[model samples]
Target: MDDDEHLLWQRVLAGDDDAFAAVFDLHASRVHRQARRLVEARADAEDVTAMVFFEAWRRRRSVRIVNGSVIGWLLVTTTNVARNRERSRIRYEGLLRKVRVETVPDHADEVLDSFMRPAVRGRVREAFDGLSTRDQEILALCVLEELAPADVARLLHVPAGTVRMRLSRAKSRLRAALGEDHGRSTLAGLGGTS
Candidate 1:
């Protein structure tokens, strides 16, 4: 939150359209950059970025400005939006897999492998499945969405310090699950000798 941002927020809160546009101009590029890093698809990133701004506009009253740090809020929102998109993609892929399994017997293995590794991918999914829902969401938000810990905390409505602690626990659990001899065997069975 810089001085200019603070000023723009003041005007936005005062109901100035120009001030709102200024806010968009100031932060849109950074938002897009963050989205691109998370989504890895140009069009998807653009759409997500637009949704972030739209959300900001819709929730303008709730957007409090403390020392011009709206960027953190925006980043958190963008991360959540990106995560939603990822979830939607996963569901769509699952439905598609079900359809393909029923209609096309020849491509079942290939379709499953496409969703994950032929053999190794299952271990990865199993490790993820072992985590609690909150742990999984935190991991996806921080690791897959690539958001900063502070931003993740804001999005989850928890303290930044709590985010750090939860992330540490989640990492430890994932590492333990992935490091056991059985996990190693599973990985090997997936055809990844290493």
Candidate 2:
């Protein structure tokens, strides 16, 4: 037996959380790598890794340590967990296919479904393009890049209030170009207001 591993396992058996954490830290990456080899998605591999550790902790008393290390057992459990998850996923996909349903989108459904309409996007782009170069720069920095007004002012070598004013003017011009109601609705829809 590896004396360190034997001691750690004994501590784990004695219900030491730190010992279990140490064991997990020692083996988790190896288990995750094994799981990644067996599963298609990184997320699925991560899930399998978590389940392997959970199973180890849940059945700690029965977990077999091989060659004075628990890694061999953890790796085997990782494979089993990955296989079980893959089988469950296949069954779920099959059931979904059997019960597939289709529905036509209504106007409200269509509006809610899409983030922005193509026509609205075109108009917004056109409006943005029509702005002066300075306005465009200010808008891009403040809104698109999500920079703070103070940061933008520092970057442009201007006062913070000047940056805010320029941003306000750019937004006003865009709103005017898009028309009042349409612009407000569009901005609100996109989770922004000016």
Candidate 3:
């Protein structure tokens, strides 16, 4: 297996598009899964996955392969990509906080606000953001994505029972964050019909 991978990598080094695609096909899912563990949204995870592969190609010469697998390097790249995005998000939020709005109320704004309910959304977002990374990940996988506990367990490499327990606890904490009454309905919505 190691020899096959090494040969394929050598082909990649020689500018074989097919070999590069083969490598991506072999590792894309694993890279995406790792990215999802660090990011909150599915879209962001997908972005990170793409960025990881892009980086792998761009820095192909520097990628380390151990035991015939480049997965370790891919995972490390995923972590760096996710952290960079998080830092960017933080800086953007800080910039938003610094900006002051002093516009007069408009009828169109009122109409949009009436239906959009930005306040409620903000509250829910704030509550969700307050959770620890593990809790957030569990909620994102099981609740937001509506993935089965067993599937999440497999992806996370944890027992199904542990996934269930962590999900329960995470839900409870989300409730605490949003206040019980509001949290119950919101959790159901966020978690879907599962």
The estimated TM-scores of all candidates read 0.48, 0.54, 0.53
Count of backbone collisions in candidate 2 = 0
**Over the stretch 1-194, how does candidate 2's per-residue lDDT look in tens digits?**
37798799999999999999999998899999999999999999999999999999999999998888999999999999999998999999999989958886569757654746687678888988998999889878888788999999999999999999998888778778889888777656643556
Candidate 3 per-residue lDDT, tens place, 22-49, comes to 9999999999999999999999999999
lDDT at residue 154 of model 1 (Cα atoms): 92
In terms of lDDT, model 1 sits at 0.81
Report the number of the highest-TM-score candidate.
Answer: 2
Q: What is the lDDT of every predicted structure here?
A: 0.81, 0.87, 0.89
* lDDT against true structure, model 3: 0.89
Regions more than 4 Å wrong, model 2 = 104-194
Given candidate 2, what's the lDDT at residue 112?
A: 52
**Candidate 1 C-alpha lDDT tens digits along 61-161:** 89866666688889989999999999999999999888844454678677656655646566677898999998888878877677888999999899999
Could you tally the backbone clashes for each prediction? Answer: 3, 0, 0
Please give the ranking of all candidate structures by lDDT, highest first, separated by commas. Answer: 3, 2, 1
